[model samples]
Target: MHELVVTPLGERRLVLRQGSSKALQLPKARFEELRTSGSSAVPQWLADAVQARWGMDVTGRPVDDVLLLREAGPYAFSRATWELNLGCDYDCVMCYLGEKRFEGLDMDGKRKLLAVMRDAGVIWLQMTGGEPLIDPDFPKAYRIAYELGMQLEILSNGSRLHKSHILNLLRTYPPTKLTLSVYGATAETYDAVTRNRGAFHRFSRGLRMAIDAGLTLDLSLIIVRGNAHEADDMRAWASSLGLPFREYANISPTIHGGAETLPSQSPEYLTNRAPFTGCPAGVTFFHADPFGRASICKVGRDPNIDLIAEGVEGLVRLGGIAESLMLRTGGCSGCKLSGTCRVCRPMAKVFQEAKAPLENYCQHGSR
Candidate 1:
């Protein structure tokens, strides 16, 4: 379909993509206006802005409302995340994979998995890690996904990105964006957080090289007690490099069932709350682990269906399973803290000991 697709860009903005590559960014209010009016005529101001920024001439281009709304539909699985492998070169203290060995599909198996994803209507695919670049078959898999017309994203620690082979592959079939996880702004704090003596230098070098190569890059700060003090510095560093930056404070239990890296919630972070309305996991998005085991998300990793065996049909069937999993169960049903309870089914399963109003999560409870 040669129609514009709209996706949310954070809470305040929306991104519109047409065909395989062209895209335009619009403010939430302007996007709402277009959605409600269903007007084919593009406003002169918006058209000029798009042309000036993205160099797309949409002066009188007709916007396909039906296609746009269809993509924006709640049931659409337009985006998917693939954990390419659970292996990494660095052993960060806060690693979610924790000691999990890499068990991803081989080259042939990955191709089959990509075909299934394409059939399942995933247009935007994020290849993540332990370290996606370290996966031996990543280049071929990445090229295959690009060939299948999927917008690609890579999440890495910037260790192998500077390698000539890796740089060449990226140049050949560049991703829409590459997100690097920055632990700290300085070497001392970075090494302390990552526990790799020369990691900071390598990460800095690789990130600089990639930027110099003119690759689209972004940064995320993994906020934890050890590196939280450098949050401002990290943001400043990203800003100095003219790159986008985001910070994440919450830490879930590792895939290996270890909570050693789960940090104490800061008072400011603890004030934020999630609504009782169920999460958009299996409903709109899904995650496949290294071995092609599909789950709603990494944290809520129950009901792991083997996507390799069941294919896209199996992914469709996960909706019912997801609904079942969302039901409030023992110690969760009608709890006084339901309004503010951070515990979801998968999280309860992760920390079974804290099933009943986790003391650490409860703001009223003593820390």
Candidate 2:
């Protein structure tokens, strides 16, 4: 494995070190030069920059030894998020996925789907799930993505992260980011929220194990009704770990258009969001479900294109799908308050489909 990766991201180019989000921008001409520089020694400037930035000395190394290039393709997507499976050990009520069904591609199908993603120009990939660590096929799939030259980020609940095998896998091929969601500060509250007894103990054990392994990690502090009282404790705990954390308070309807997760939202913790702006979901990135169904984003999953059947050619339709989903249509058509809308079009559509309260999503609430 090369110490550095150089990949084309849409029209942009980046030089990234594995296990780190920080990247150094490369000019398109410079990128192309390196791609064509076969058997050439590492450039003096690049070696110096890499040494200064990442403290890795690549002065006398061959170009191939130091840099791994992920070639761009005719296909459009530069980033993608793939669901390895929808199976979880702990059932969190506030999960965006309404039903945590154990379904998705088998090992063979997973390999094919990841290959398609790579050929389609997906340089940055996020492997997510109903708790990706619990999936039996996770280790191989994770390794596959890494070997494919995709910068990976794993979204996990941290329940099974303490497992020796799991840690070994992660330690061998570190992800660019490993984001774990923290439900509560205490064991009792944590188990109560996830409806899994002894979950907090396991969660703590996983954190310690991951830290001891010297793995890079980020925390998502899930602020919900059950854990709202312990908000300060959660923040303090994250600070104590010295890991960067982000708070998620505005719980949305599930991807299945169900209102189940909204009630768990903590009203006091709710933060006002900026007005809706245009998004580049299908244009720049897309979400792939367990079965390899590609959608504009996670929330806008319908009218999907099957990646297995169509391959990268399926992504051609995604731009149109994204365009159609973003337009103000149906009940929202001709709305004069669109400028003041809080959420994006796809998100609004999900809330509308769920029959969520008007006050939760609309400016023209019941008067």
Candidate 3:
């Protein structure tokens, strides 16, 4: 079947690809028209624009366009985040995987896992970690995923990306994007957060090299109390680079239930609560840990099933199990605070040391 892949580039721009050969960036409105009205309704100007840019022969491909547009239906699992390993070189203060032993799947095991994901219809795969680059076999695994036609992404600190071998691998089989976490604006503050001397310098050097290599890059600031003062500077630095930047404030407990990295949230910080809807974990998204244990989301990891042993079908089966568990248990059930409560079943499971209603997460008093 012909596949027309639509990927959002920015505010109103989108990149539309036909198979792996032809791709062109067009306005979102035109893409929507093509999506809803089929290829026959495609404006003559739009067709000419695509053909002029990519030199694709669209003379008698009307049927193919219609089929491709219609192919954008729901799949069992469309995207996945695989934590290649929990190992990282720098010790960041706010890291989630605290002192957790790194146990990633071997090369052969990773190949099998990728095959399972492909069979399960996952089109987008994000390779993340404490730092995915730390994995020795990451390049081979990444190449395998690229060859399998998965739109891939990597989340890293950019410390090792400047290395010749790593850069060569990235240039050879480029990922869809690379998301680098910027700890702080300056070397002092950045190294303070990382707890490693000269880490900021390494990160900056690697980031520059990656940019020079023409890798698509995005940056995020992991805002914690330590670097809260430099938030503006960090944002400004990211703006200087002209890359997309985001800030994350909410700090969850460590993935391994270790000591809390950041301090407890103030009552004022907890007061302004947004409405709680269910997260798209087991349903539409899944996170696989180093050893192939699959969870609904990274923060809401629970009832984790071994994906290596049970395979993709195991994940599918666990979705219902996870959903049922979330709906019935924890402080979420029939609680008035559910509207404003940030605590979900998985969070409750992680921080279950306290009583119900999760006073730390509730704007209202705990029940």
Candidate 4:
């Protein structure tokens, strides 16, 4: 009986709570509208297609909405994320990016990244680091991304957001999104994950400052095996703040140097996962590190290929990166749970390192 969310994927969906589970309820009427609307139309030639099937009119009306029919296809990749660093000030056990001490991206390094993204024709670029705000060039880098005609998203630990200069950027260039990580419900839970005593207050206060500065905000909570019970409380926290939230299962350990801290969730957790129709790794997204390495995922940084050397167009043609992501592997191909499985480069890396069959990380195929 709740309101329906008309997503860009051409689906008018509603979320219903059945017992302890939250189910996304979609109607048959909206599905038909999605098919007939010009706004929902997707380029038939593109391989990355979670949003491809939903057609729309010139003005962007979903076919399902236009025809008042049932919707089809999965709604995924509502957005894309790019990592700016593998380093973090805190050693969180669940973070797939920062289990070790890694250096932040410098100013010059970030400009090259922006240039590479523009050349790749990316419309959205996210700046993520051990904590992006920790890097002094964050504001300048965000502006460079915007100047390149790309909307920006920032994932920060919220430590440096309290600065007036940083707040000025939030008021001026204002990113399309700003995700602040809330590790725990209280300082004890937060400190446990961050391993820093006062991080909880800094993050909380910075978050409030950002919200007050008029930045579009969202939240992320990485759920380790030991912290699974925090799901309900996490959701409540997100709701209270009126932010779109996500609680991800920590699978890949944050790999930097020789440190790989894996989450407690095993392969069985994704056994019955939902089918992800396609991977948009190289098509809809391309990540560029501070050092100018262009990769499909952030965790693929160690041996990353340089975009400056290969060039964006050549990289896409030779990499065949996007195509590699669509193939299904064990547990993903025919699993009933395929509908909800979240596969990224990190998962792919683990599968490959273990030499597991059908492990498609980056959603891209093996090299």
Best by TM-score: 2
| RMSD, one per candidate, in order | 6.8, 1.8, 6.5, 12.1
**Clash pairs for candidate 3:** none
TM-scores, each model vs. reference: 0.77, 0.94, 0.77, 0.64
What does candidate 2's lDDT look like per residue over 1-367, in tens digits?
Answer: 7878898877789998878778899888889899987778999888888888988888878898778898886767788998878878888888888788999988999999998998898988999987788888899998888877788899988888889999999998998888999999999899999999999999999999999999889999999999999999999999999999999998889887899888998988888678878877999899999999999888889889999999988889999999999988876888888888778888888888889987777656764
- Model 2: residues with Cα > 4 Å off, grouped in runs: 363-367
Give the Cα lDDT of each candidate.
Answer: 0.74, 0.88, 0.71, 0.55
Candidate 1 overall lDDT versus native:
0.74
Q: Please, what are the lDDT tens digits per residue for candidate 3 over residues 1-367?
A: 3424444322433434422334566676766766665546446666576578666555445633522431221335667899888888888766768785678788888988888776665667899997889899888888777665567889999989878999988876667789999888999989998888988999999998888888888898887776778888999999998888877766656777754653632222223445556776787678888888888878766678887798866865657856775663554466655655655667666665333234555555534
Question: For residues 1-367, what per-residue lDDT tens digits would candidate 4 score against the true structure?
Answer: 1111222233435321111112233364543344454556432321122233332122333433322222221222222355566667777765655444555446776677566555554545677866777666667777666554455678877777878888887777667678787777777777777788888788778788887877888888766554556657877877998888876663554454222455355333333334345556654555666556666666444435676566554444423554454444643455454444456434554555645445323322332
Q: Measured by TM-score, how close is model 3 to the native structure?
A: 0.77
Question: What order do candidates take by TM-score, descending?
Answer: 2, 3, 1, 4
Most accurate candidate by lDDT: 2
Please say which candidate is ahead in lDDT: 1 or 3.
1
Error of 3 at 322 (Å): 2.9
Candidate with more favorable, higher TM-score: 1 or 3: 3
Q: Could you tell me how far off, in angstroms, the CA of residue 99 lies in candidate 1 after the best superposition?
A: 1.2
Encode model 1's per-residue lDDT on 263-337: one tens digit a residue. 533334433346556777887689998888889888777778898999877876678878887776754565665
Ranking by lDDT: 2, 1, 3, 4
RMSD of 4: 12.1
